[model samples]
Target: MNATQFKQALTHVNLLDIRTPREWDDFNLGGFHVSLDTLLERIDEISKEKNWVIICYNGTQSLIAMRLLKAKGFTHIDHLEGGLEAYLSL
Candidate 1:
């Protein structure tokens, strides 16, 4: 979804920040960080029952992550369009 739509859905979604540690320390948007590189290995750390919104620096990584999750049988996954950059712009 777009930034505005993501923001509106924030309260009802579980955010997964898939940015590197350095990027996360630079600017955090209140979600748990699992870095894209380690996401697959750490997938169990996230709850499968909740709606998850994957987030990345510019949204590309998040989209990739979303697809990965889907392939792994996750049905309630989405990516924040434009990522944190778009959210900060608002």
Candidate 2:
């Protein structure tokens, strides 16, 4: 999803930020913070009930994380189209 859509869905979907901890500490939209590298190992911490919106620096890692979650049986998954940079551009 685009930044606009992401804002609209904020209350309805859970946000999964896959950026590095340093990136998150520098700036964040607030939700769950999980680095892409450790995502699979920490999958147990994520809930499958709520909708999810994955985000990364430029959408690459988020797209990858989205695919991984889907393969793990997560059905409602979405990702920032161009990532935080795009969102910031808005």
Candidate 3:
């Protein structure tokens, strides 16, 4: 998403980095950092009121994250279309 769109969406949604911790340290995203593997374990700690946007290096991991969240019954999970590439390009 573009910077403007991201900012606008932030009012309703939260960004989530689903990559591994190594990946997170290599390039951190500006929101909640939850590794895909750990997210399921921490589902109860997530806020249902806030929408979630999954992000990763190239969008693949985000898609996986989205599917996983959905399986857990997360109602407002979204993913960056092109992951960080799209955000940085904007």
Residues 1-90 of candidate 1 have per-residue lDDT tens digits of: 999999899888888999999998998878678999998999899878889999998999999999999998899889998989999899
Task: Name the weakest run of 10 consecutive residues (lDDT summed) in model 3.
Answer: 1-10
Instruction: Identify the runs in model 2 with alpha carbons over 4 angstroms from their true place.
Output: none
| Residue 40 miss distance in model 2 (angstroms) | 0.4
**Candidates ranked by lDDT, best first?**
2, 1, 3
lDDT by residue for model 2 (1-90), tens: 998887677788889999999999999999999999999999999999878999999999999999999999999889999999888887
Ranking by TM-score: 2, 1, 3
**Between 1 and 2, whose lDDT is larger?**
2
Q: Per-residue error at 6 for model 1, in Å?
A: 0.9
Please name the candidate that would achieve the greatest lDDT relative to the true structure: 2
TM-score (C-alpha) between model 1 and the true structure? 0.94
lDDT of 3 by residue, 1-90 (tens): 444576568657677888889988888746888888888898787777778888887788888888888887788778877777777776
| TM-score of each prediction | 0.94, 0.94, 0.79
* Model 3 stretches astray by more than 4 angstroms: 1-12
Q: Supply every candidate's count of residue pairs whose N, Cα or C atoms clash at under 3 angstroms.
A: 0, 0, 0
